[model samples]
Target: MDVRVLGRGPAEPFLGAQDLFETEYDLSMPVRVRIRRDPDERTWTGHYPDHHVLNISAQAATSAMARELALHEYAHMRRNEEAHPSHTQSTAEALYLALAGRRVERRKLTHCYQIANHMKDIYADDITLSVAPADKLVAFLEASLATALADRPHDPPRWQRLTPAADPDITAVNAAFALALCERHDLLTPDHRLYDLAHAAADDAPGVSIERFKHRFKTLVDDPDESEYRKALVDVTHQYAVETGQAAD
Candidate 1:
């Protein structure tokens, strides 16, 4: 698949700072940027495996805000690259902090965030952790991948630091979190549609894009007893796939 940026309008002149970042930033790949007066997504950037930004769009954000959001997204790409001595920003996390990113910051360390940080630790200890156990206490860092994938199909305005796109495989981790959260509390109605959708997405014949698949999967968590609706939706999704040429290939 290819990511093509839709440049529907006149390209906005590159502001001085963005121009500078475009020329001087440590981007691993070239990113196409387009500013819009009104975008369905407040601020979003898509990237292909080519490491290029397929599209970066924002609807009239101040230069400072755009700069910060760009830096924030950049951190997601350069996340694993350790900083050299010449580089001041060591980890992507550090770079985010340096840029004053993150919508929420705990004055003290948080148990939820810490637990997510220690997911590897729990595995290392060889202790069997219950799936429903850590519903609300997973670390932000650990759950980061899930949150990223979740936002791709529905990139809302506010999910910063937690809304970068991720690979489809990461959805399982989030699915686990959803189930665990529901088990701990009955927030989900029994007729939820997502349970079946998740199974369908995991099935050999996933009939939609990963983001769409996940959106459908989340439908269950929102309604637990909607089995008939879920069935009809599945059939509709399959029929739509056939009509749209997805099923042919």
Candidate 2:
């Protein structure tokens, strides 16, 4: 897959890996990866960002987990992390409102607002949120494509490598958005990304223990006995169900 330098601005050389990469690796930003010492050469260490990087240590990565990570990082890079995040209440929202100009619609905005809140909760521990509904994200993609097509009709995204989300910089926004949406869907089903990844590996470390995973997840939300986590989870689930037309309560 050709590394698509996010359509926001002028394309430049890709980043990372001096010895291994002959050419630039088109990686988007907010990139996250785990670094490991190469088994063959402990003197040299290998860096594996989410999964866009072609050079990966097979022994280091567990199947497609690395790939998923790279993709996730790439999506973060491409999506609304730069000038505009996917969801910001004040000026940012107004900006998207101006550009999309009532085209954005209330549902998307509200949904994205919820998306922001989730991100806030997720990153509350430490990571931090730059901007969710980043203006650069939507603006860049929309403007880029609008300009690109204005000259001559181009292709309709060759292989869905990454999606064009709102905001600026990178090209993985769509992937991130879709993935987040899927995760939200799954979680309302109350599944964690870890569980999904573990099951995908199917390593058979032990018997399938969904209950064990749930217990672990309950800790993750900071003691389900605590009112805030429980209430938030309940509200998020209810909202999802109501929106998706699967509302039981």
Candidate 3:
């Protein structure tokens, strides 16, 4: 496998990450990696499966976050090669629920995509951590939780300004709950601080309790039964729409 690092940044760190990823995983084809700064980029790194390109943000590269990002994206690339019927099914169900209603707006549909993508992240994180070093994975999870906690509002407004009906607090809690579920399942190490932060966020969100939220999240991502998984997705999407005042007709 030929791994090339492009664009300007600290080449050594990125090269080191590439070396580690190549050594740990088998790549049958060439892949291009680059680091670029984008203020609007929502992720630390993204994998373009079709182009076989991986892009890491300059900020993430400088902070040593590129290592995990690379490995995570590599896992995604590998998964792309091996078909996952379950992911395909679940994603389809979520999208159907998200767009089933006549009231669906672009932003609302985008929010559904966000939730579905995060659901995929849980599976990808599992694959990456399976082969990657446990300590390194733990460190990455810790850093991720710390960043989420820092950026989260202590008392968020009931609804986002742009999406008046969508409760930002609930969305944040759901995201945190996904990570917390990973920790619970041993994909990531359990950290009291991370759990506390998730719990606190749930507490502040009306009608959301920590334990109940965890159960729903687990059902959404980890449930073995396909029917139950679809049901969970429907329930989650319904809740989001209800909270946002965009319930389907």
Candidate 4:
């Protein structure tokens, strides 16, 4: 496999990450590592059957966390190669089928996609954590949730619903994702900071049951066949729509 780093930024970290990931998984395709300067654009992987690209923001590539981030994206690339349901299926179609005839708000429907994405992340992290330490990934999640919680409104105005970042449902799903990751990796402890933030999110969005979504996503069977994964997606979408009062009576 040809792995090329295409940036002025240091290539050692990314190349080292490729070596680590290749130990556990076969990277059969060529890979290009592109570094961009956009802070808001996160490190992500784009995959085609024959080749893949791992794009990292300049800020992230320069940071010590680059290897961890690259490993996570590499796991995603591996899953894509394997045709994993989380990486292959249409989340929107699953939501439409799950909530058929129910008029869902566009915002709520969007949240469903985020929930589905959390599932994908969980599976990808499973592969990553197997090959690397979980400390960096765990720390990243903690810092992200802490920031979001600090920025959240004590009581968001009804008008803030127009923004997903300000939407309580979005926060609830975010919290669920945090909880699901902790659960899947057995990272939770009584003193862990995530416990409090997740509880705060749950209390803030009483209409959305964080546990329900957390359980559904966290317990998804590894290497699930298409039907099983689709069913899981449908179930979570329907549950989220109903909980958020998106179902037309």
Candidate 5:
């Protein structure tokens, strides 16, 4: 792995993370790490068969979750190398297959992609959680959902209006994903506080059945084939579209 600093930021975090990750997983191909000076730049990892690139915002590189985030992205890299169904199939393709002729609003289209992302995250986290502790990931989800819920608008019912960040319907879906992931790993107890947050999100978005989606996403089989993954993605997308009133003509 080659660490390349783009503008200005500490590369030590990434180096440390790479060391930690390489301790458990083998790095077969070359990896380039780009650290951007801009704090606002989006942090992500791009996986290719020949090489891999990791881009990190200066701000994100300083965060506490940097190592865990790197591990998660590296897990994605490994899966992509293996041609895992979650990494091979494009969610957009599945969305099209699921709602080709349906009348879905442009605004709600983002949610479909977000839900698809949750499915991919589930598989990546499966690898990540095996090596790293789930503490940071779990904490991040709880804090994020709690903040979204607390920042919800006061005007009109939550389902009536959609703000990109604090939309209750999206928050509900996020909570469902969090609950499903945690439950699938047995990370939370029956009386955990996240359950309360999930319940609160469900109450805020009456149109979405959070429990059903939770169960649906939670039972995903491990290492499914390409067809199975696409089928699950399409089924979940269609269900979410219809349940959230996005498929209405």
Candidate 6:
């Protein structure tokens, strides 16, 4: 893996940890990881699949967050190349509701995206937690969860012209789910706030167990039976919405 640093200061520690990351994650593939300062401060970190590059905001990277962010992005890369599924299923579920003559709130569809991505983050965080120090991981989870809870959107637009695929809440929900999983795995001390945030973010699309969601998400991306997968996904999500009282009659 080739690690490159564009701007100085905040990204230096992330660059320095490149070797440690490779060793810990057993990353053997040739990928270029780039760390740059985000002038806009719009996001904590991001992964660009086309360029195989990871971009970290200057504020996030400088604040002792680079290690975990790197690990998170590394997990995303591995999943993208290996086991990860497309995020389109969430959008599809929303479309299913629309086609069925149900008025789907944009927020509900966005929650669906959140649920799917959060599940993936749980897996990603698992990989990161495996190699990171226990104390550091615990601290990271604590801080990240607090940030997620504080940043939760209280008044999201009731409707939007954009598809659920464009929703930005995935990032917030990802952090919440990561923390919830950390609490579940005893990586962090039990905290009701973490649980609350996780469930609240997922409240719109309820009744589906996390395990079931994980299975469905994986099948949606990994199953060779494309037609069956699509049908099953739509059926399952529609049933879930109806049962949860999220679907219009």
After superposition, the stretches of candidate 2 with alpha carbons farther than 4 Å from their true spots are 1-34, 37-60, 80-82, 86-117, 120-180, 183-249
For residues 1-249, what per-residue lDDT tens digits would candidate 4 score against the true structure? 577889768888888888888778867788899998787777878887679999988888889898888888888888898889999999878987898888877777777888888889989989998888777887888888777777776655563254434566678788888888877889878789888888887877888998887888778898899998999889888888888775685
Error of 2 at 10 (Å): 30
All candidates' lDDT scores?
Answer: 0.35, 0.31, 0.59, 0.82, 0.83, 0.53
Per-candidate TM-scores read 0.25, 0.21, 0.71, 0.92, 0.92, 0.61
**1-249 in candidate 1: lDDT tens per residue?**
111234553232223223433443345555555555555655544545554452344453443334344433443333223221211222233223322322222311122222232221222111112211222233332344334444444333232335344423334334444444343344445655445434433442233244443333333332223343334233323333342232223
lDDT winner between 3 and 6, please give it. Answer: 3
lDDT of 5: 0.83
Candidate 4: clashing pairs of residues:
none
Q: Count the backbone clashes (under 3 Å) in each candidate.
A: 14, 29, 1, 0, 0, 0
Tell me the lDDT of model 1 at 105: 25
- Which 10 residues in a row give candidate 1 its minimum summed lDDT? 123-132
Model 4 regions lying over 4 Å from their true place: 156-165
lDDT of 2 by residue, 53-137 (tens): 2233334234323333333334333323321232122434433432332333344344444434444333221111121222222
lDDT of 6 by residue, 146-188 (tens): 5654554455533453433322234333544455566545664
Give the number of the best model, judged by lDDT.
5
Kindly list the per-residue Cα lDDT of model 3 for residues 1-249, writing each as its tens digit.
566778776766646656666666656656677777774444433434454677776776676566677777766666555544335455656667645755765666666666656555666666666666656555555565556555555554533354334344445545466555465556544554556656555655555444654556555444345565566666666666566554457
lDDT at residue 238 of model 4 (Cα atoms): 84
Model 2: ten consecutive residues of lowest lDDT: 166-175
| lDDT score, candidate 2, position 140 | 35
Checking candidate 5 for backbone clashes, the offending pairs are: none
